[model samples]
Structure formats: C-alpha cells, structure tokens
Target: MGLALQGEKIARNRFTGEKIENGSFMLCDFSGADLTGTEFIGCQFYDRDSRQGGNFSRAILKDASFKSCDLSMADFRHANALGIEIRECRAQGADFRGTSFMNMITSRTWFCSAYITKSNLSYANFAKVVLEKCELWENRWHGAQVLGASFSGSDLSGGEFSGFDWRAADVTQCDLSNAELGELDLRTTDLQGVKMDSHQAAQLLERLGIAIIG
Candidate 1:
C-alpha cells in the first residue's frame, strides 16, 4: 500500500509481516508497534517532512524477533531512536546519513553498504554487529560498547570511539584519520592501510611503548 501517513499515530499496532512500499511516514509515530520481519522500500522512518527528525521516538518495537528483513534505501535521517533494539536485522543501504542517534542499541545487526556518515552515535551499544562496506565517517561514538563486532571495508575516518572498549572487534582496511582511539588496544588491531591523524600519532606511539625523539 502506498500509505502517506505523515505525522500520524501508528502506535500499538501489530505490523507483523507487513510489506511497506514507497511509504512516507515522516514525523509519524510508530512507537509500541510490532514490526517483526517487516520489509520496506523507499520508506522514510525519520522526521524528514520538516527540518526536525525522529518519527518513532516514543515507539516500542519489542515484539517477535525474526531475521531476514530488508530495509534498504529507507531514510532515517535525524530520527529519534531512544530505547529501540535493532536486533538481528539486515539494514542494507538504509540511509542513516547525517542522523544523530541517542541511546541506540543494535545487536546482531548487519549494516551492509549503508550510509551513516556524520552521525552522533554516543552512548550506544553495538554487540555482534557487522558494519561491512558502510560509511561511518565523522561520527561521535564515545561511551559506546562494541563487543564481538566487525567493521570491514568501511570508511570510519574521523570517528570517535573513545572512553570505551574499542577492541573485541575486527576493523580492517578502514580509514581512521582524525579519529579518537585513546585507551584502545592496538595489539589486536592493525594500522596498515589506515590513515592516521598527526595529532593522534603520539597517542598511538605511546600505546606501542615507543617514545618520540625531538
């Protein structure tokens, strides 16, 4: 159905196995809805109808946990994502570009070929997440937890992963220039083919127990 329910109340509805196509729900409320295995096409989830964002800010999506759902090309720009669990889902090409997320939790999620660049991702939890071929540049990820996650072939330049367990993940062939990697364990991470910021070189060198000579 080509539903254009912008800024409507879609809360507490069971959208189990529903197929949304070209649906624009910008500034709408999808809180407390059962979105198990729901697919989307050209669907807008964030508040994009105006300058502000977040359509499902107060929505509850804690229903049946199923896998194999496609959310490609869906727009979530500047959306409110408080208390949302994006567990075990495939977000291929889901447009999260320029979105600032607050208190986000994504476990066992596959962000393949997605664009989340310049997003504020502070105070989030990403366990068992796979961010393959994603654009995550210039994002703030301080006070976040990344466990058993892998970021391969992704552009993570200028991202802040500080003040957290920045290890316990495989981040290969990705850019890291101008990024905050303080208190991170490099014993398990590689610096080859990775761009580094000149200001952050001393911290990286100090972590390797190497003193710089003037």
Candidate 2:
C-alpha cells in the first residue's frame, strides 16, 4: 500500500490501490499513466513554472481519491476521471479541459484561475469550492451540486447550469450570458455585477417581483 514509481519515462504505468499518504511530488511528470484507484492522501504538488506541469492526459483515473492535495497548475486534459473524489484539494490554475468527471465528488477544493472547458461534469458534487477567476466555458454540469460554492469573476458563458443548485454561492462579476438559468436557485446567491443576457435579466427580475418598464 506504499507509494511506488516505475518505468523510465513513467508512461503506461499502472498503480492500483496504492496509498500515497502525505507525499510531496513537486515537478513530477505523470503523463500518460494509468493510475486507476490510486489513493493520494494529503499529497502536495506545486508547479512554479508552466513548463513543469504535472500531466495526467489520457489516464484512467477512475475512483481515485485526492484528499488535501496542493495540485496547482496540474494538467488533467482528456483524462477519464469517472467517480473521482477530490476533497479539500488546492487546485489553482489546473487545466481540466476535456476531462470526464462523471459522478465525481469535489468538495472544498480551490480552483482559482483553472481552465475547465469542454469537460463532462455530469452528476458532480462541488460543495464549498472556491472557483475565483476560472474559465469554465462549454462544460456540462448536469445534475451537479454546487452548494455554498463561489465562482467570482469566472467566465461560464457557454456552460450548462440549467438545474444546478447555486444557492449561497457568490457569483459576483461572473459572465453567465446565454447560460441555461432555468429553475436555478438564486435565493441566497449574490448576483451583483454579474453579466446576464437581455432575456435572462427579464426573467430574473420577474422572479424577484420587479416590474420592467419598456
């Protein structure tokens, strides 16, 4: 159950059921590795330069748990991350473009300035996550739980958030133009300085009992 690294280039490496507790992997290259069901408990990863990014591209990371990891500037593009649980992870500036996160649970994770475009995030839980200045356009968030999460200054114009519960979330200064806002709960959410479409603004005003004068 200990941490193990094999292969010269670390490509096509498999590590199932391995326990990597409290490990600090700085500037490690994990590109194209099959790390299915790996338990990364309390791991810290810091990529100072963009060139020293941790790559998890095309990796099968199903059911993998990353608890309390500092994964700043890590690249997880095109990774199969089904049912992945990433709790309390500091994932600032991480690239999750085209990553499949079906039924994933990501609670209390800080995704500041992260780019999550074209990702499949169906049935994902994002409770209490801070996504400040993040680019999450064209992402599918069907049936996702976003309770108490804040997305300040994020660009989510092309994201699908039709039935997502955004209560108590601070979405101030975020661009949500053309996003599906049908049945979205904005009761406890802050919509101050948020950019909305003309139709969307009318609908939101109607919901708030405000009469619009043409």
Best by lDDT: 2
Once fitted onto the true fold, the runs of candidate 1 whose alpha carbons sit more than 4 angstroms away are: 1-111, 188-193
Residue-level error in angstroms, candidate 1, position 82: 21
lDDT string for model 1 (101-169, tens) is 333347644235344555455544455555655667776666654677666677888777777575666
Model 2 / residue 196 / CA error / Å: 0.9
In model 2, the Cα lDDT at residue 31 comes to 69
- Candidate 1, run of 10 with poorest lDDT: 61-70
TM-score, cand. 2: 0.48
Provide backbone clash counts, one per model.
Answer: 6, 0
lDDT of 2 by residue, 1-214 (tens): 4343322345565456677897656666666777878888777666455434456767777777777676656677777776565655655456666666543247644234344555556545455655667666766666665666677888878777766766646778999998887565456667888898888888877898987889
Model 2 scores worst on lDDT over the 10 consecutive residues at: 1-10
Runs with alpha carbons beyond 4 Å of true place in candidate 2: 1-111, 185-187, 209-213
lDDT of each: 0.53, 0.66
